[model samples]
Target chain A: MNQADSSTIVVKRTIAATVDELFDAWLDPDSLAQWMHPGTTALSTASVDARVGGAFEVLMHYPDKPLRHHGVYRQIERNRKLSFTWISDATQHSETLVTVEFNVASAGTEIVLTHERLPGQVACAEHTQGWTLAFELLADLAAKPLVLVTFDWVPEMPRGFVRDIRVRWALEEAGLPYRVQSVPFSDRNADHFSHQPFGQVPWLTDGDLSIFETGAILLHLGERSEALLPAGPRGRAETLEWLFAALNSVEMASLPWSLLQFSGNNDGTPGWNMMDSFLKKSRLAHLEPLLAKREWLAGPFSIADIVMADVLRLVDRFDGLADYPACRAYVARATARPAFLKAHADQMAHFAAAD
Target chain B: MNQADSSTIVVKRTIAATVDELFDAWLDPDSLAQWMHPGTTALSTASVDARVGGAFEVLMHYPDKPLRHHGVYRQIERNRKLSFTWISDATQHSETLVTVEFNVASAGTEIVLTHERLPGQVACAEHTQGWTLAFELLADLAAKPLVLVTFDWVPEMPRGFVRDIRVRWALEEAGLPYRVQSVPFSDRNADHFSHQPFGQVPWLTDGDLSIFETGAILLHLGERSEALLPAGPRGRAETLEWLFAALNSVEMASLPWSLLQFSGNNDGTPGWNMMDSFLKKSRLAHLEPLLAKREWLAGPFSIADIVMADVLRLVDRFDGLADYPACRAYVARATARPAFLKAHADQMAHFAAAD
Candidate 1:
């Protein structure tokens, strides 16, 4: 067995709409507004350019706040393949890529999303957990039957990264039933790579559909559930903006900061110095203002909180996050959820068994 | 000015809608579906999670082929900031980050987007040009009066990259007026960083808005005019997916292939050998399939083709791309556009001035 063999979480659900209708929900601005948010604010004014080499952008607004988010379409294939580049309104130079695939299945539209080329392994793990939870939420919103497959590896299973907790919390919040498919790291193999293109664990397969990357899975799940996202235009937009902030803005900064523990040899190498500088200027500096403004990053207890809490947990592992009181408090709120408890317990049990 | 300073390109445009309204268009999935794809198809579904710690995803579908794109939100600041990660369903492992900011302006929203933390300098240059053209497309979609601001630097003047052709084409396509501000590279003052985040040329500003990266610029421009995108759900989705394939999938592969020229040095290193393997495995493998199926990358002549053509042009620069008849045909189709001709002529004129 190898690291990829160990599985930690599983989800199953049935959607209310047909495969084509459910798939169409992704393209239609109105349908998107209907089920995009779990329980926060609703989406307002959805717009898109659905074409080859066409530009697509969306703005989501919160009624009481001034927050918003924008995205551009990188690629689009009707009901089959979609990809784009994403960035936040807050920073100038940080960008990430996301892709989702929808395959028609006997059961329904089998959706598989793969988010790749992350900065490093740590990011991969963090996103793996976050995406798992979000997908659960999506299943709930779509009222569709779905399944999620994930694993927990030994020796390097970042215990501090609490993204699993978020997934668990979303499931609990939605009052959904799920199962676990724990695979020991010793059992991982090439087959796992077939499921996860990168060979990393924490992948999900819904019937014939399979998805890798935590962020993409989370989105798939979130779109299905009403408990994970809000129901109105303003609320939904607010929720969406926070989602971007958590994955792109906060997570981007935290990845490098958390990696310091593994790479910090205290040597005078240029790479170390560069990493250190990035930690100071890029990660820490931006986080300060972000945490100071809100109790939950956005409004209510959305997936944004889940992703941020997980990222913060990793930062806390190295004692780097002690300075941010808001972040610490936010982490506490997210972990308090019952689903988070279940997810964490499952991870611990799986890790113990592997040991 | 030196050769580096001679080839700089500047682009700009204006968009209607208030700063908040325009900003909301980004966060709201519904609004995104509207102007997002100006000339292509209508958006089928648009979803968002606009919160700090939330996870957001948008999937755009095509009208004809089996292509779909999904994006995840990473950051958010009410009405002021947003960011997210981008990935492709095809590659599934490569991820990139993008960010945008909305400033409250008396006239309208001054949106500034920054796409950063790319793999390296080569990727950075290509992204800058691609983003610029995208922003130009955005401006056209928005249908607001706008202007273009550009700067000339001695070292970074004509920022030589393939995507510049796309930016020039977008400007001509929209028939938008633009101006340039020349800066000598010798003057590495703080102001340079303010105009061009990386201190490179091809930076742009419209009214209170300032942006860097050709892709972002094209999106901004496309938002102004509806002509850049298709008109229906499937058409718009196809356009967006093709855009992503051009930038993330196709361009990514082409970049490494082109870099081989720089690596074949007299230093007696194995750079050429590494480059050869890279081209044969990565670039050729992907291009073969992409060219076999589509006449244009996505459909018709969208921004995706513009960017793809520019990137593929490099293939001819090093070795002839004639082997790929489909790719050659696509290039011819793209170049045949009147807008492309003007952009090419403008670029040539700029180069001619350098002599």
Candidate 2:
């Protein structure tokens, strides 16, 4: 069975988590069961013997049948690498070699998976396809604990106004389950600043990756599902483009204007109001034409639409979107989604519970 | 020769350009010469007979050897699709069918290329590798004419303060050649408003894609080269995070404060100056510890560094970064790159020539 020209497939992915978390997940029965199976395949069982020379087994319950996969651990380098010999029902004696290496990347861990020594052409091709799907699931599982941080309570004026709602809306749209953690509104301590540099609420943590910006957190979630982002490159690029546009261009103008109104400074300064009005109006005017033709910002209701809608909703709240009918409708359409309704309801309930 | 199970390799990329422009580039000899070959492989000659049933030839001059690729046009549908039969020295008699289809993507055109009918396994493997490289090149060529738009002149106070410098610096860092187009500073014409709704300088156009916002433009350039943005996913994600951090988080705070200083409104308002100072100082203080440990924002000299450095440089100019020594040093290190020096010099020259 020594096919000298046997093919080897290598797949690499960078997950926004530490090496320890990712490496441990490979050996943890629960984590392995969650991600080892391909799309829509249920894991019947995952038995892990994590040490060298130990055995492990996983059973995938497909719609038609169940497939048993067994392996013997050959090497285990904690937080660094692992290698094993794979044995399956179809290729019980062939014994494929699979090696996974974890390298510390800039912000996370890069996992390099090499599957070697498949018996024949068809098996090689099928294994390659399986690994691709499995790796994507692994990437999703490795970046875990998508936590949304907010305040325990806020005044009625700023109740729904907290930034965590944007994140909740995104998670609901993507159908990803998450937990909400709260800090006391009265005291902003060192722990708050450690997670969020600005000591602001709505910072997110997926595994070890803690990001402060709501825009960044939305993008991190967008990577997992096409419901929040499109699968194609064109849609993904445009989504990122408009995502930045909402944050930097639209929100940058709307935020200060909204702040001035809240602080009762809209009519206080000599030229601040005029500058604020001109800036907001000019940005809205630029957006009118695009919204007139397209239903969503990046065609198929992507995170771009989510972000742009969220930014404009604030404007809509302040009655600032009256001049732009298309943008107003866009926001209306986005908010009318069932996911948005649930997210808004959940957010309201969470804050109301505190009261 | 009729290998029924012959392999077909398909590659698709969405270029941020119109279909008409991308189609013309495929036929234009000059454009074909620029992107027909893979990286560092020079195009020796490109002779075109673009009409259907006509033949065309291209010579690729690699350092060690020369290769000639000949093809005959089978069908052409101006901006939608094209098909040809490819004949090379290796497969002169066993010609391959190559089809390219263009579809309107969300923000641009998506090109799908299929290379079909390889005679053998080795040929199939070789062709797949070739097509992948060629497709990457085609994507770069398809998105052409990266233009940076700025004002013809600005007052001495905002001379170097122009936002276009950020785009220019990014382009230089990516080693991308770009053209600068200027609008009249005195009149902010309708054309200016159309391109930049805020009548701001420093929007960019790549082929048919015209995008405003310096942050957006830098990201567009970052897509072209890993020199500006890391090719790895982790670094890229972190780069985007920090890029937004510079814009939505840091610049959002700094720009208004700097503008107030430029307009000599620093001492005018009793509470405005206090709010401005508190906002700027708070943001800066948050940034200090991060800069202290890392040489670059995201652990590499990426577009994130370029952005954070540029934003902090402005703060330093206004004497606002006095408390943040690490940020100051980081900016100095980034500006010290030859690419930054060239971009700064070119931007100054472009404006000075207008004067």
Candidate 3:
């Protein structure tokens, strides 16, 4: 009847590594500077305090931005556990808790991390989904000899519409030989549901494992090929930040724009008007400045570009993106890659076959 | 246009280490084991494919539950970028992406990570928020000699209500010195807005960094202490899973339960009985089994406990939780903490003064 019985979310991960090795990396600040961030810039400052009730901080600076993130430690439990509070001075939002646990397993070490107690339901659900994706990426990056796998499905393929361009491009950019698993929209049914939770095409499988979400699959592959992300802690952190901006900041603005076009109504309904207004304002206020300088969101052709380009591409379906020349040029550069072309062709063929 | 234009969420972090020293820890499977999981069990079955178009996988097993997580690599860009997909085969509905980028920053390597395209808006926001907290935790764990800082505030302290016990307990657990920042409910001025985008209380700061969300702040502290998270990757992952479940799954289910009791007032109206019955059934069905399991939601004392305790506490306030012994016990343990007591006392005193 203790307080432990009522929790709902549980996170558990097992990695193949010895406990001592894992503990050393966690305890030593030097080791953290390595894999902490997968893509983007690099770490500018990192300091540690490992004793109980001690405090610590890490500052990650982006070469392309004026912002710096500072994280402070709350608790330290040697090799067994680590806990801390997270905050972004730039945003001034309430901090969140992150707890990491380590133990020994037959194969190696098992890591358990719990980030809990977001302010609201919306925030909680969002973090749950995002963390799930990030963990997958971590596992793939940690894997050895890197494995790359890809699948191809077209937008108009099979009996319905599918968005397979993302996976195709990911495979192409990573230089992985992939196969096509196209399904007509008409045939996407219970069988598909069993394989893909969302009942969508462009699902990917590596060995016996299967993934449905496009972004998740792409990140997984990026870990294997190291082609979609940057190398270094600060770089990786920056890459992750862009990923969030793509999904949250940029994507949030794009939704209404897409919805307005999809609905195909110009009426000034309360919701529609609100959406349109939001889209217009957000684009001018946030996105315009974001694209004013950088050729890429982070630096190189990381998955951040892939995500932004995909979302931005959808904007072209509705409002021609000519007004945002920077965004347009960025998209053009991203799609101009040979690998992107191959992936696009493969996806188009799948859809054409459906026709 | 400057670097800030290209990047919005960049930070300047300086560390002392060569690129090879940092990169090796992430690339070498053995080195990864050291810091991969800070709190729980060590990693098991770690493998990597460092080349482009390679494959990678990591498997983690949970000792107390029949759960295992598999992370698959999707792309890798050698000492540069890594992406992967995470999946929980047992859940059948779990899919996520994680991208990590590595780069050189000053004398050390910077890592940027992006987890893109979560399931939905709610999921995306929550995950992004969670990452901020987790990053703080990671930073703290990396820093050995830590200096902890924290803050406490009540939800409706301005109106003489104190419900932010969790924040206080977290601070106490980490044994950090802190101060209180009070806000009035009626104060909707720019000052409040500057501190909290959502105008909520329980905001915190660490040196120049500030955080507004309670959950995020807790995680930031937890990462520094490593006391709240289990050891090992598997354990760490599982802990994170529970953190999500507590925040989204169980907490979401409890919402209806609370609304039914306090906001129900059927009056035999249309959809009244249906709504009430639905809420009752949903709440019971979701919680009964969760209570039947082990003492804690994930294991031992963790952030999941803090989150679930808060959620259940809310439920109890509306309708006494006498029926659910496990849940009730869970609440009792959380409230019994000395930090919780101090927070409650301080909140009460603040409210009393306001009155």
Candidate 4:
């Protein structure tokens, strides 16, 4: 980038992507097709030769007409940097030097794009605008790099009920990319509360959208893929209603009820009797009939089932669901889901590591 | 219903609407514009004279072109029946007799729509389907006839924490039509459990769709209108995440802590100490920053605010918000909304009546 030359322009973006991932997006045709085009243009079709001296053509489909840009790779240093010659009609059909550097940054990877030796000031400005628009879309590549926030460790009693398992289950179900970050269970600080107001485990960060609460995070992930949430109006409605049901309805009883069981406080105290009666009469009894009739709560397998099954799973752990065969069966069926199994195992491993 | 005659057809539906509301839907032009369509047509431009022997014309916008269906009121019986002369292109441009009876039934207002003097079998079949389609939309009248089921009464300690206030607050915020139904607090039978799995009160019935759990019910109501929820993606995403944060994150700590207060159990016991530590450290301290920064949890007022405020209200009842001014102000800000005031008053009244 020549700061003194008015004919050259540079743009930089710090993307939440790994070094290799950001570097590869520029060379892969499929990846290029997703983010290479200017904001005004439709999808760009590209074919890349990848190595040095290899030629590439990207045809961007605008509403009015198609524009083709051809370039030759001058240098390729794997994840480090790439320098190429870019020739387009906007550049007066002249060859220009384009370099992209993927630098390892504290947050993620920062990409510095330089386009030099433009036709004049206008071409430089156009290329700058074009690259800026492309970067806006390129930022989407970072959106998938989710951070699942939860406690570092908890006791055996709250193992499955640690709640992060719900989010892990959802991320797995959606086939999303996420990494778990644990906070200190014994010592929570002001920083932790900023992300999760309740200082609870299982908050999630998707790009800048940091959301706490298991149900909220599940919903956030559910919106990412139909595997977690359906797209249609009817199915979406059912999924939303049922997902809330698992947390607000089923878990409202199950959580406190499970805690009592954990403490062995069910020695027929008033608190114990109140919780037990409510669990047996209010929750499990109603769940039995509904579970008996349906394979899943909503029309298909969805995030709603993930929450509902997890809520009932806690009760079944304490042998609370013994009489409710359908509820028991439903729990077994949902836990048997490959994603649930993976999420559960992952959560157990996360805690074991902390221990 | 005209069971004996094949030429005459009758369609009946038990709509969860008041007799007066059902009868009014037939006479009102705005109401006609809502549901009076052939299932394929767009919004209907309706102009109704309403009185006996008065005319009405509904111009339905179909994909291809516009269609005009005209009618004259032959009889007007307020809440009882509506007899009119129906004519359209499908009726061979010939006049037909249509009578609608709104009878009070055990479940709701049952509407019997009978059409006679059709041109032929094809015309009869077409009108049968058209009216049936109209009824399908008319059945939506029942959708607003929400039945909020909760406990009849509880002690003063559990008065404001009854949970139904969440749904009631949502309903009022949305300005939706609903009625409250009470189940026995002491005795929750098999019948009560049918609607709610945890035999909990506060399960909601929206026509045929019954959803239990305060969060689920609020979401269900939020979907009905943007008043309790935003329609835009960003706003909705914030609403959903914050709502779950309120319940699963904030209330997860507050509920148990409040229970300990209700029992006056502050003896430094392990359970009591654990609940206390979590409420102050994990929840309120974290919530203070967010409440201080934002006027509402989402971009605008939403169901998320309702749940969050209500959760804090319980804590405030026990002087829990004394240390956190932001959390206290947030609760005050939310409860000051007219809907919350009405819901709280009505809940108190309902329990008081039972007492």
Candidate 5:
């Protein structure tokens, strides 16, 4: 939320990093440079002394002009609060006070930013927008070192469809930077459970928060950018409902059926018959009409689409979606996105590299 | 986030209702009475006139003090913003300015409340806490009319373990108010798919957000209180990671195996053997040590416990936990909670009512 007046601006954001991690991101020159710019690829240059009276400077490489912002540390209460005197071209080259409070909250830090002694209403408004974009950049930058916990390699059978691909698709779509860390499929360790309880792969670690469950990972990543989840209400609601619909509603049944397909036995047995009917009637039949009506699950492509299309791709792989044209089309539409293609290729290469 | 100084108080919360719905919640006296009180069960009295220059009164019945808050609306922009002059005991009976801006966010409204012209620092601080508490109460009350979509009835085989029970357990634990809406199991309709794409019961409809996937619903309810998800970083992270573990990691394997058991066939087939081995080696074996070490999945019993215990209960029913005492004990510990017992009894009665 951003609230501005004639002389001050306040902004707050809930982030998935610890107070210590967040506090350091500000004072550490290298870290400060990563996300201090407007675009994900745009990196700033920063120098920090990081003491009570230390000096710090960040020069943002804007396309129009290189904007310079410099400040001196006014207060530092490690992991709790930080205050500095800020000066920038946008601030009329006059010093303004910026205080950041890092409140310990579930999953990360609740960062409250107060920029006081603004020149006037215009500066207040501009600074409000400036900090908002900076935080967005900061979030995108945080994704750079994100550790995506996944199986190093599996047999060719599940190569492209492994759950980690869902997280990959979202990250690629958002254009967030990340590197993959893998655990061999046949080897799971005690340390793995620390990241993922049931010992499955595709848990995401960002700063202090380690999130598992492919669905949960997708949901977590969805919060990072509007590309994964639209910031608008209607689209967001549709994306969420459909995201769950993908997991519980569609994949919930499709997954079991796909597993049976993989085993390639008991084709006409009682259990097979029941599961087959459930997937066709309870899952696919109900989903076909809805898919035929919408371009994506939501208005634009979203994290829900990534999850659902991924879920549907499995069914298509096993020929389970032979009868649903709309479902197949929806999958095609989603996978055609450059993000999905890149994610898929990277997953294949990751397994290949392990080999 | 709540930030206050001598002259102002600012509080913002991302809530799960439409801007229109949220805007009306402030001006509709009847709606205001439902959630304007501190406690979920405690109802306040409210009277409002929906226009600029109109007055509104809300008398909250506290344990000892019947605090009265009255305000005259200065500006009213439907579904956008509302500005008023507020007078209350907490503000030292001062006629302060309160402006509420409703921004359309993904799932609902991002409500920004700015209370300015406070009497002094004490008044500002007190009002900040007061507004935070009031917003918390509003969120709890919004859960009042939540409709839990579930099956009317199913056969005895899946009766005690319908997925809806997971949602019910969280609701009971959080002490949130809700009612069940039954969709007949055999009669799957388009209406059902609208709420649940897979036509599986247990999607939740909370105002504009109809979240499906038992996992997603639990996460949504988790946002309402600390009982479901603690507000601390570690507990919250554990709950999230484990909640997904139960769904994608544990249940992902258990459900298929359970379905085979339900059919009472393919006991020793290759597919059954593979599934059995997977359930034991990949899931339970890895889970036992972690479960044996901790009484609850998180620091305190959390929504993750609700999901994991329910998942384990099903596997236990099939005699799957025979060799895993730790998993068995963990399930028992979770089920032994009063909230779990109430949720179980109510689920049983709900099915029996259909009969």
Candidate 6:
């Protein structure tokens, strides 16, 4: 369509997020599902084609009806701009042009969204409200880069087994950018306790909010990005529940058993042997039946898998998960992810740098 | 304030919740905190006076400042009506009468909230908007009565140890009413698997939403009521983290160790003995120092405490918690709550009813 024949409407919003992060939200299918829809409508299905001339489709689900929007990417400029042709069943128009420009602002990223080739004024007005609400949601999420805090170094045995790996894996999986800060493991200061009351590592700082507990940090991040979770309430709830199950149920057993193995107490006493058997019969065995039924704990790869895999990997180190083939395979499948590999390498390098 | 002299504004809503459940939401401190505030604002504190002439106070906290509202309960009728006086610094009037009437509706509960004795037109309009939003929040929550599904009976050992206790405790803590249904323990049919994929008891159904996993159920309930959780983001996050810690961490070890003890396999196998020792040395011992520093796990009484206490209590029965004096005291303190008492009694009676 010629510029003279088409009409254009622009909506601008300043978000409290980095240019790259905010820009990535547009191209990432998971992130788009989280904030693209209006009101309480959830994205039932979202698929992305990030390159020029590639096509993308997203199905927005409401209680009564589902609205599917599909478009072809006409222009792609990472962290700067994105332009595409949009068509939806709800709209009378066969095709419309939508362009999003991301500019670095004092606070964060300023997003300028322009919708061109509108059929009429009514469609423009309706889309204006929809885009306004969508940006508001994005702005709220892009408000900050979550800060992950951890230790500079730890004991040799637990070197790769640090709690910070969970946080790193979580951030990497979500495709969220974060900076890591370190504290002394042996000599924890009052400030450390202020952030993490237990004087533990892997607390998080998101803007003015300081949150302790690795599970809590993961949950906070999960709330913002759909990569670690899902937009549907039931899916989100399942992810959360499974995440807890991994940490509280499986890890609870594995941690102690691994500690015994690390401390040279493996099969040393009756107690040590009993603990090993319990880990095998109670935690891992129970998990086998559950894992056998599905590849992922919550049906989709989520934070639950990340935490569960991390914990179970420790058990596998001691060969405790041998009988539970499904559990072992589940852990292997999760660690095979590029995100997990990067997180593992980065964690090892972090401690190596301090050395 | 007499009805003749006062100006009353009635905000009516048809919620999708049972009359008893909806009515109890007002008297329940936890339930009130979830839906009482406007928009994203959270309750800092909510204390209930569920009797006639008793006083109550609720502090709604914003990021910048806090708004405190306190008044006397003029009347209370269970599953019928609740009337109280509303006062805040923002208001010119010292007191305003607020009455909420709950009636059974075709969809759910029809709630008519009457706010009387407005100072001016502006105040009237603002309060109207605030109450309207608050009711919308309630309607969203009350639209579903969470269902707790469990087995009719189990082994003598796992009788009181059923997972349903966690749900019952959470519901009681939040002052939310729920109905209990049973399945045959010997044969968990396909219908049971539909609700609980794991074929376990204690799945929850709210409206059309059915969720399994005890941790997930508790978290779901926490979203609706502040009693099982806290109103503030930090508190709620902490509660969630700790709840996971209790279930995944503490319960993971405790369940196995307790099962070994109950089966009289305490020293029967080397694995059982080792698990018992690990439970003592790692899980329970690590919890002691933390409990020594605080009365509750997450600062305030929450589902975290209930789940943790329940898990630790099992440890106590096996004499594993003897060394952890503080953990014992913490469990004692949690079980002492009236809600916990009622929940425990109800759970016991539920099994008894089948017998």
CAPRI level of candidate 3: incorrect
Q: What is every candidate's C-alpha DockQ against the true complex, given to 2 decimals?
A: 0.02, 0.21, 0.01, 0.23, 0.27, 0.20
Model 6 / residue B177 / CA error / Å:
1.9
Candidate 3 structure quality by residue, lDDT tens digits, B1-355:
1222321122223345455544554544323322343233422333455554544444443455433434667776667767776554422446666777777887566666665534555554554454455344344434433222222222352222233456666666666545443455654566664554334455565655555444445555665565576655445444544554454334544543444344443334323343334334545444555656766765677776776777778767766466777777777877787666655554554343333
**Model 3 reaches what TM-score against the true structure?**
0.38
Model 4 over residues A1-355: C-alpha lDDT tens digits? 5755877888998887789777777885545655788763265666677889998888787878879999999999999999999998898999999999999999889999989999888887888889988987877744656877788779876886788888888887887766556688988898886676556677787766777677877777777799999987668767887887777656766777787687776566555666677668866776788889999998899999988888888888899988999999998999898788767766775575445
Chain B TM-score by candidate, in order shown:
0.52, 0.59, 0.50, 0.61, 0.60, 0.60
- Residue by residue across A177-277, what tens digits does model 6's lDDT show? 66566688789887886676556678888777877667777888888889888989878877877876677556766776786687665755556656676
Residue A71 Cα positional deviation in candidate 2, in Å, after optimal superposition: 49
**Model 2 CA lDDT for position B168:** 83
Interface RMSD of 6: 4.3
Off by over 4 Å in 3: A1-164, A176-215, A320-322, B1-355
What's the C-alpha lDDT at position A272 in model 2?
67
Highest DockQ: give the candidate number: 5
Clashes of 1: 265
Evaluated at residue A281, the lDDT of candidate 6 is 72
lDDT of candidate 1 over A1-355, digit per residue (tens): 1234222112223444456655665554433433443233333334445555544443444556533434567777676677766444432324555677776667766666555444445554654564565455456556643434555446645653434445555666676544334444567676774554333456444545555445545544565676676665445445554554455444544553344354453243433344345444555555566567777654666766676688777776677667767667667777777677656755554444333
Docking class of 5: acceptable
RMSD for all candidates, in order, please: 25.5, 22.7, 32.4, 18.6, 23.3, 21.0
> For model 6, how does the per-residue alpha-carbon lDDT over B264-292 read when each residue is reduced to its tens digit?
65764456656676567656766788899
lDDT of 2 by residue, A1-355 (tens): 2334556767778888889878877886545655788574354346677789988887777778878898999999998889999888655457989999999999798888887877777777778788788878777765547767788678888766678888888898887855566687889999887777777788887766777788878888888888987766567666776787788778777776666666666665643654465445668887888788889877788777777888888878778888899989999998999778767765665566455
Which residue pairs clash in candidate 2? none
lDDT at B189, model 5:
89
Q: For residues B253-350, write the lDDT of model 5, one tens digit per residue.
A: 88878887877864687667777877889899988998889888778888889988999999999899999999999998889998888778667756
Model 4, B116-230: lDDT tens digits are 9888787778887888888888776446467787886788867766889988888888888675666889998988866665666788877667777788778878878999889
Task: State the local distance difference test value for candidate 3.
Answer: 0.53
Model 2 lDDT on a 0 to 1 scale? 0.76
What is the Cα-based TM-score of model 4?
A: 0.58
